[model samples]
Target: MKIGLYFGTFNPVHVGHLIIANHFAEYSDLDKIWMVITPHNPFKKKKTLLDNHHRYQLVLEAVEEYPAIEASTIEFNLPQPNYTSNTLAHLKEKYPQHEFCLIMGEDNLRTLHKWKNYEVILKHHDIYVYPRIADSEDQTQHELLNNERIHIIEAPVVEISSTAIRKAIKAGKNCRPLLPQSVWRYIDEMNFYK
Candidate 1:
C-alpha cells in the first residue's frame, strides 16, 4: 500500500484541507492519504492550538465521510520535538509493508533544504508537491529538486488557511461554509475560538 503523508496542525479542520487531501487521493497514484495531525509541542506552547485530542477529533470528523482520506494521530505517540525526518523513520519501521511518500506544497519544497535531515528525506521517500502561491515566484527550480523522486502534482491551490478560519470564528463570523459541517458544529458547540 502506498500512502501519502499530508502533515498539518489542523487547528480546526476545514474544507480546503479536504479539497487537497481528496485531490491527492483521487488524482495522484497514492492509494490513500493520511492527514497526519501534528501534535502540539509542549516546549512550543501555542495558545491558539486546541488540545491534541480536540484537534484530532476535528480531523476525524472532517474525514469521516471520505474513505480515501483518513485522520492519523501518529505524532501524538512520537517523542517530543519530532521532525519530519523522525516521523518518516518511525513510520518506515512501524509499517514496513507500506510505501510512504510526502504530500507537501511547493512552498515547503522551496524551504525543504532547511528541514532536519532533508537530504535523507529526499533520498528515502518520494515527495508529491502541490501548487502554492509562493511557488509562482521561483521560476528556476533548485538543483536539489532535480530528481526523479519529486513529483509535482498539479493539485488545486487551496488559499483557505486554518489561521484565517480561527480568526473568523473568534470574530463571530459565519465560517460554516469554510469547514466541514461536523467540524463546524464541534467548534461551535465547544465554543473553541470564542
Candidate 2:
C-alpha cells in the first residue's frame, strides 16, 4: 500500500485538516492518507495540546466517514518529542511492504533542514506539500526545495486553524463551521479547550 503520512498534534481535529487529507486521498497517487497523531511534536509546545488519546479519538471521529483517511496513534507508544525521521524509520521497518510518503505544508518545507536526519528523510520518502496561507509560493529559493522528491499540490485552502477554534470556544462563540460536526459535538460534550 502507498500511504501518505500526515503528522500533526491535531490538538483537536479541524475541518482544514480533513480538507487537506481528502485532497491527497482523492488527487494524489496515495492509496490512503494516515493522519499520524503525534503525542508530542519536537517543534511545538506541549502545554496547549490536548491529551494524546483524546486527540486521537477526536481525529478518529472526524475522519470516520472517509474510507481513505485513517487516524493513527503510532507515535503515542514511541519516545517523547517525536521526530519524523525516527518515526519514518520505525514505520518502514514495521511495514516493509508499504511505501510511505510525507504529507506536510509548505511552511514545514521551509524548516526541513532543522529536522534531525533530514537528509535521510528527503532522500528516502516522497514529500507532498500543500500551500499554506502564511507561506510564500517561491520556496524554490530554499536549497532543499529543489529536490525532485518534493511535490507541490494545489489543494483548496481552508483558513481555519485549531488555535482559532479553541479561542472561539473559550469566548463562548460557535466554532462548528471550523470543525467536523462529530468533533465539534465531542468538544462541546467534553467541554474541551475551555
Top lDDT hit: 2
Clashing pairs in 1: none
Which tens-of-lDDT digit does each residue in 1-194 have in candidate 1? 99999998888888999999999999999999999988864334577789989999999999999999999999889987668899999999999999999999888887787789988998999999998887265433466467888999888888998888988988989989999999999998899988
- Candidate with the greatest TM-score versus the true structure: 2
For model 1, the run of ten residues with the poorest summed lDDT: 135-144
Go through the candidates in order and give each one's C-alpha lDDT: 0.88, 0.90
For all predicted structures, in order, the TM-scores are: 0.94, 0.95
TM-score computed on alpha carbons, candidate 1: 0.94
| C-alpha lDDT of candidate 2 relative to the true structure | 0.90
